[model samples]
Target: MRPVDEHVAHAVSLMAPVDLDEVALAEAFGRVLARTVTARYDSPRFDNSAMDGYAVRAAEVTVGTRMRVAADIPAGSGEPPALHSGTCARIMTGAPVPHGADAVIPVEHTDAATAEVTFYQSAVTGAHIRRAGEDARAGDAVVAAGQLLGAWQLSAAASAGHATVAVRRRPVVAVLATGDELVDPGMEPGPGQIVDSNSTLLSMLVTAVGGVPVVLPRCPDRPGAVAAALAGVDADLIVTAGGASVGAYDPVKADLAGHGVEFFAVAMQPGKPQGLGTVNGIPIACLPGNPVSVAVTFHVVVGPMLRALLGAVEPKVLAAPAAEGWKCPAGRAQFVPAVVESDGSVRPATGGGSRSHLVASLAAGRVLAVVPAEVEQVYAGDTVGIMTSILENMG
Candidate 1:
């Protein structure tokens, strides 16, 4: 079997960007942009007021200097009136500063009247004024392609005069769980039965990574039933949670071989039995059956592949420092569920290790403290890698 890292590297090599489509800017949240967005017009458009005040020439706003009131310009109003010599106009916030005015004396600093307003303070050139194009110039690329759109990106598009954006289409993934002893939640299980959780977990994981998940029913341990379940699913990525191991009843390994599936296996704890292949040119990642094993493999293998399919240019795992001591068993890398404290501390959750099947530990983790095979002990203050929480910033 390939080392865990090498297996992931091979899986990543097969990834490619999905096709693109234009979606309304309002509907673009959580989607990756397929094209660059440029500014249609200069931000601020023209010089405007930053405060409700009297717009006047900075040379004219001396103490006790009185200037004739020209015209009032409120925000969102029509064209402003030009300021005559020794004159000022009543300007509200965001109103365009009229020609011949280089400064704004706040209304609070001036006495109001039709004839003239008395200034209580001196004014400087360009005071309280927003310069045209200060935020962005016209035709400038504001948002680059491949950026995942969020509220800020949508607002930027709206500010740039774009009502919609071209984004990569979400990839479709199919999930199947194999085991005759497994049953769906709420089913009364016979003596050897267990609840089927891999399907649900895989579905949620696929959705979290921006893929559409189609969960196929559990494939029984029997060969015929397993083969039937593997067929008839249309998906870009197919995931099966069990039957990849060397066990006699493990049928997924043989089933995929019969259907000509490729790519399989790696050396990793609680998840050594895994598969990755293509069925009819669609990518398939067959994860392991153990719940914790399923979670780890999905995040390590399928998660990055899905993002790659959505056009993430430099797809790679982001690591964080390990805040506490962690021991790694030799020969296989380990992914430990950890809570990344606000102060950068990583605490392993109550469940001890991979065999614990502590799915709750997965929920409690904001990061994963990865321990390499060669490392016997990860000490406090050591910088290990962390996988960021997918639920932290949902749109």
Candidate 2:
């Protein structure tokens, strides 16, 4: 049996970040940046008032002293008349500060008037003034290469004056689920048949990592049929569910054997059956039929490849303490669906055993607590590696 990391490394060696393309800022969400984004102009662009107030000099009227209003400056006004001695400019929020004005006095601090305004207190220089380049300067690097652009990053890029961004093209993943006993949802099954959920699960998983998922129809266990289904699929990666393990009615591994596919058992529980090969010059990753196995293998092996193909970084894991004690399998590494408590303690989310076929147990947790192969027994307060179920925790 091969280690999980070794299989992931081999998968990554066959692929890299897709070509770069310019996409509109609206469409660039969740895409990895292909180049550094520099600021086109300084933030605030010019000195402006941060509040709706009067722009005036420090030598202006003291407490209860009335000063003549020289000009009215609203936002987007090209320029304003310079501040004359003993005069102030009526300015609105976000409007440029008039020349010779050193500070802003809020409208509330001035008496309501048209021609003249009375200040309740002396003005301080540079108060409530948003200076040019205070937030970010022109030509400064705002967004770095290889960074995934999300809502915050997109907002920052927009603030930097970017209408579009160069980002890595998303890889297309073909998801095919196998098993003659599998039937689509909302259909009545006769005798021994189950609904096909792995296809949609894998497709959603593929899309979670920014890859475009192309889900194909379910393939039967026949070798010829599986071979025909595997042929001529246009995708960067082909992911197949079922027929990967050593079973009597499984032909996914045998059908692709001639195409350089190698099926093996991973040194991990739940997802022991794993396969990798190239079919029609496209890389195919075979995962087990069980829903839980599909999820575990996809996150451990396929998630890394997706990250590598998108020029993204590896997921970060936290060593959280366990809230309860449990014995683990002797030889294989175990991954149990668990939730972190408010106290940051990890506990099994499922009220059942850690069986691969227990599909419903997968949704009981937000993270997967990992127990190494050597850990035969765990005690309360013991630390275990954590893998979050959500995409936000991946990076």
Clashing pairs in 1: 319-385, 319-386, 320-384, 320-385, 320-386, 321-384, 322-384
Error of 1 at 169 (Å): 2.2
> How do all models score by TM-score?
0.88, 0.86
Q: Model 2: runs farther than 4 Å from truth?
A: 58-67, 108-115, 118-125, 318-327, 340-346, 371-383, 390-395
TM-score of 2: 0.86
Candidate 2, after superposition: displacement of residue 98 in Å? 2.7
The global C-alpha lDDT for each of the candidates, from Candidate 1 onward, is 0.80, 0.85
Model 2: per-residue lDDT, tens digit, 105-135? 9999878565898889888889999999998
Native-structure RMSD, model 2: 3.1
In model 1, the Cα lDDT at residue 365 comes to: 69
User: Which candidate's TM-score is highest?
Assistant: 1
| Candidate with best lDDT | 2
